[model samples]
Target: MSSAMTNERLARLYDRIEIQELLYRYARGVDRKDWDAVRAVYHPDAFDDHGNYKGDIDGFIASLQQRHAHIEQSMHVIANCIIEFDTPDSALVESYFITYQRVLPSAGDARANYFLREPLADDEAVQGQAIGRYADRVTRRDGVWRIEKRAVIYEVYRGMPTIPGGRLRDNWTISSRDGRDPLELLRIELGLGEAR
Candidate 1:
């Protein structure tokens, strides 16, 4: 191939990688409750249709915060990211995700008192899983790719009583929701702190 064509192919590959990183960032932001990172994944005027909620980007973030507030822990895992370029400046993308959440037990709920060894009821504190796909319209603006619009399609949802003694023990290292993960210390030690 000619040098020009090779360069064009390389650029396209870079764009694809960047878009994938953007999707990963979105998942990390959601799991970590880093609203600023979530907001950065989209364009300033992006639109989102998340099944339970539909609105502009700001409204979407607000809704997420409200919904997540009642959860003890949450994680969003993204996979199968595919990007198809429609033009030099626009592309369509889809990412598959599985979201897991442990909801806080309601007040006076037997499950809330961990000391009790009674069997859990069907309606007790629960763990939930949502399998979904995110279809997005992405555009390149000022050489940066960001989501212009996104719609989530949930394929399945499951909720079950939390398993007895399922909680993690103190031995496990903890990750933080405020971007202060222990990995950050490693990053600083390895000269990766400047990259972020």
Candidate 2:
């Protein structure tokens, strides 16, 4: 293959990796409540249509913060990403996502801790999962790729039943929702910025 063709192919591969990284970063940022990281995934002028939220990045972030304020913990899994280049500097991306959240009755509630001996009742807490797809229009501007516009489509939502566990879960290392999470600490120690 010609050098130009090889370079083009490599560039496409790099763009693809970067786009996928954005999806994962979004998941990590939201789950960890790293708002800065979440903000980094979008362009300044971007618009988001996230069901209940349909506006600019700032509003979207505020909505997320408010919606998650009562949650004890959350986890988001992103998968099945499809990226299609519409132009040399623009692409359409779709990614399937599933999020599980441990909802507390109220912020700073003592019962938020896992009580292995007892089954969590619906009134005490709300354990649920949301399945959705993110359809995004991503563009490369000044050699950096970021989402220009995005639409979040909801597919399904269901509750996660509490399952009793033994001492293994008791000894598991805890991950915080803020910067104090174990992974965040390690990343910070490694000089990987304020948040990952």
Candidate 3:
């Protein structure tokens, strides 16, 4: 009986870790524009209700790609994740997230609609920030965990002018424009293939 209980605990711990990792990978995929990695974490029939955007997985993917097109840099941090198991293969999850993005000046008039930021001049850039919680229903299918549904609740959203000459890069590692970021390239070199 004690050994059986230990096994159950181990299984639960493993599930928790897998679910958390799924959320982290989702963030990484979005920041790096790695759509395949993002799609891999969701059910085919998944629905994402992201305030301004609401639709199935395919539409969600399209919206994501479109939304970030005019933005140059994006960073997302997920924290305070709480998970509750509904069944051996299903769980409810809530994860708090903060996202920071730098919108290019070329966005110009288009920024007013999607970005909700003021129009910028030819050489001006703006930074945007949002704080939200992702309430998700996650399920394990074929021994793999994925999001079945997700609703993003925003607590804060705003944009401001970036400080001039704020960029101070001292390292050689630069984030790639495509999904072939340095980390992914290194992982591939080590035979990891961009997934855990």
Candidate 4:
């Protein structure tokens, strides 16, 4: 192959690997509940269009922190990523994400309902899984590609009835405009708006 062809092939391979790593990092951060790490996978101005959090990165994290609290354990599986290179510096990626939510009964609730003996079994509290997909627009900035925008569409939620939390309603008020701090909004929602 010519040098140009070889270079093109190598670039494609590199982009593919990098994109896979990016997705893996996102999954790891989310599963581990490492908000900072999850935040690092996106651009500073990134926005997400999740059915739960239709706003910026701060909104997304706030929503996640609230929504995932009821879930004792969860897993995110990413696959079938179709990445199209618009140039050497930008791409559009569509990835399939399947998330599983395992509910842990609260201490009081578990003791009252599911406790068959003095001690609880390890597996008794698991709820089930929720599957979804991620449609994203990624861009390379400073030589590192990151998700610039993302929209999560849930295909199915096959688990126990969801427990309502204050987090879901928090993002509903966020405008599409920039400069809103999600944490501030959360504090306001909780009636702790005063700076500590």
- Find the candidate with the highest lDDT and give its number: 3
By summed lDDT, which 10 consecutive residues of candidate 4 come out lowest? Answer: 174-183
lDDT of 2 by residue, 20-58 (tens): 998899889999998888999999999999887899999
Model 2: clashing residue pairs?
Answer: none
47-139 per-residue lDDT for model 4 (tens digits): 989774688899899987775664555568999888898888888888888876555555334432322344544434545556777888888
lDDT of 1 by residue, 38-131 (tens): 9999999999999878889999999888776656667889999889999999999989999887765552253333324355564456677889
> lDDT for every model?
0.80, 0.82, 0.85, 0.70
**Which of the predicted structures, 1 or 4, would earn the higher TM-score when compared with the native?**
1
lDDT of 3: 0.85
Off by over 4 Å in 4: 106-126, 161-196
**Candidate 2 segments whose C-alpha is farther than 4 A from its true place:** 107-123, 160-168
Q: Say what the RMSD of model 1 is.
A: 5.0
Clashing pairs in 3: none
Off by over 4 Å in 1: 106-123, 163-166, 178-180, 184-196
lDDT of 1: 0.80
In terms of TM-score, the best-performing candidate is: 3
Off-target runs (Cα >4 Å) in candidate 3 are: 113-119, 163-166, 170-172, 194-196
TM-score of each: 0.83, 0.86, 0.90, 0.69
